[model samples]
Target: MTTRILIAGGGYVGLYTALRLQRRLRRGEAEVTVVNPENYMVYRPLLPEVASGTLEPRHAVVPLRAVLRGSRFIAGRLTGIDTERKVASVAPTAGPWLELDYDELVIGLGATSKLAPVPGLAETGIGFNSLAEAAHLRDHVLRQLEIASATTDTELRKRALTFVFVGGGYTGVEAIAELQDMAIDVLAGYPELDAGEMRWVLVEAMDRILTTVSRELADRAMTELTGRGIDIRLGTQLESVEEGELRLSDGSKFFADTLVWVAGTRPQTVVGELGLPVDGRGRLVVDQAMRVEGHPGIWAAGDCAGVPDPETGRVSPPTAQHAVRQAEQLGDNLVATLRGEWPRPFRYRSRGEFVTLGKNKAVGEAFGREFDGALAWTLRRGYYATQIPTWNRTIRVLGDWLVGMPFGHDVVNFGSREEPRGAFEEAAGRSRVG
Candidate 1:
């Protein structure tokens, strides 16, 4: 019997690790299979662009079968894992659960937006974690402009025009900056709504935006965003959400139409099912080799696994850079385990961080230097294009950047109308007839 290797969550780690294994292992050596909710691997770096209509939603996601080379693609979401039995619990797109037996397992289950008990937040807010969220935001932002243009009531117009983004990390900053920029451009198409009438606000509990970058870059980014009339609320936290009005900890309330939740993400619950040593954040504890400590034939990487940073003696932060590198090492280790060789430890250092503002504007800290504006923007694109799995994809993405330079962003609005699927009680009061 062939050695079966099961990989869960085909985001960065799942997709890349499977691809690496496919390339290294011989046909009869081991059977490699990937399990994910979707067949495509989203190029998460360009998600901000997708939300802003700078690139098509489909462009950011690569078909797993098309790019994964030679590997079995099981279109399913991993529900749980039995490490001792080497059987993974999986639920297909629309079916009951089944157990997928594996000789070795790679847990790359990824993370979800951390949702707290802020009233009405679960139903009212939109998260920017996946491609669907990006697409939904694009549609919703444009639709808000349409609503603003048609309304005569001052309060209604104000509500429709006000766009609030919570959190100012890379995801939050890039999303609001691009969407705000796109909304301004879209206003040109709607003569009735002056771009100036629209309010773009960024609320950060932290003192600065893009804390991943240098202090200088963060300061400059704040100045630039505020200069563009974006209301920067520092040391502010969201208190509650009721009747489409958001109340902040500062005792200020705004009846806003859009609220973007990019506060943070927590590791998937699959880690908890493993019953291994997990941190408070639900991340699996792994040693330098990316192996679950004291657990044989099982490895975890990406956002789901907590790989410690040797220098700081703390877990490494979840990032695409770390995930991709870890995936490569995980693949090598898994294949080595298949043979007689012992796998090497997984150690990685972050290259840098970058966040794109609007157009050719960006701020980044790379190679121990801070960069801003066009240079940083160019650097960001170049880095992602190279890191992306295939050259075919890189060429296509580079083409997108080139196309955007001359024609500008194409605003495509498609409203969210999909039926919410979950437990009946969860959707009972939440579901609305559109």
Candidate 2:
């Protein structure tokens, strides 16, 4: 009898864990199955570039079928798990629920934006967590440019041109910076619009941003952003966004059509629904070795699991670096457990942290050495290009970078992509009415 290993969530940890299992498990030793909501894993760091049109959206994702060779890939979500029966209930896109049996389970469902009860944020504001949003943002920004350039109404133009971003962490900062760069670059084509007239505001409730890295590096990022004329409100909060009017806690108000919320993320709600023992933060309670406490055959890691950092003696932060390291270690430990060998605890200190401040600009500390400008940017891109997985994807990303060097941004707005079936539906309606 072969052991069936069920891996949930095909994000960084899920995919990488399955990849490792497929490589390590001997033929007939075990069967590996991965469940995810999507068929591709979005390389989140490159989302800013995607929004800026620096890299095509398609290239920023790795198709699971193309990469996770020999593993069973189920395009769906893990709705629940029955530990007693050793089965997981998955809901597919358009079908009946599936109960997959397994000898062991791995959970890595990742997280989603943790939105607060700000007045109109839930309905009006958008998040920067997915590839779809990045693509939509690209089109949306260009559409705003078109609207501002064509309309003679000052208020409408102001509203269209003004872009507000909440949160000043890596996601928020990189997104605003890249979009701002794209907007400025494309302004040349919109002859009537002056870049200075466009308002770009960053709102953060905290006194500082990018708290993951050193204070010095964060200061450097602030300098780069503030130097570009972006309005950076240090101790600010979004009070409301009712009817396109944005009110902040600092007793200021503004009207902007675009509001991006990249504040932070919480584990996917399914983690709690799974009936597993999770921490107060709703992350699965796992041992230092990445195994779920009191469950010998079950394991979890990544953002969904509260795995402790061996060095800091604190739960590891939910980051790509930690996820990758944890998954790799989990894979080895899973194999070891299968063979009745001692499992090793996951341990790895972060090498460094980097923040991309748009094209040819970045701030980072690598190996205790701080860097800035083009060198930092190049290093950041180089590092990500290598880590994106598969030679084909790496080459395509590098090619995009090399080709983009000599050119300004591609300003063609494909907002029409958002409504692909509009024409077809109209045609069908006309035919019926005829």
- Each model's RMSD to truth, in Å? 4.5, 1.1
TM-score of each: 0.93, 0.98
Write model 2 residue lDDT over 230-340, tens digit each, in one string: 999989999999999999999999899999999888899989998889999889999999999888789999988999987889999877888988998999988998899
Worst 10 residues of 1 by lDDT: 416-425
lDDT, candidate 1, 248-367, per-residue tens:
988999899899999888887666876777877888888888888888888899988888777778877777888888999999998888888988888788888887898888888888
- Each candidate: what lDDT? 0.85, 0.92
Q: Please state the error at residue 234 of candidate 1 in Å.
A: 1.6
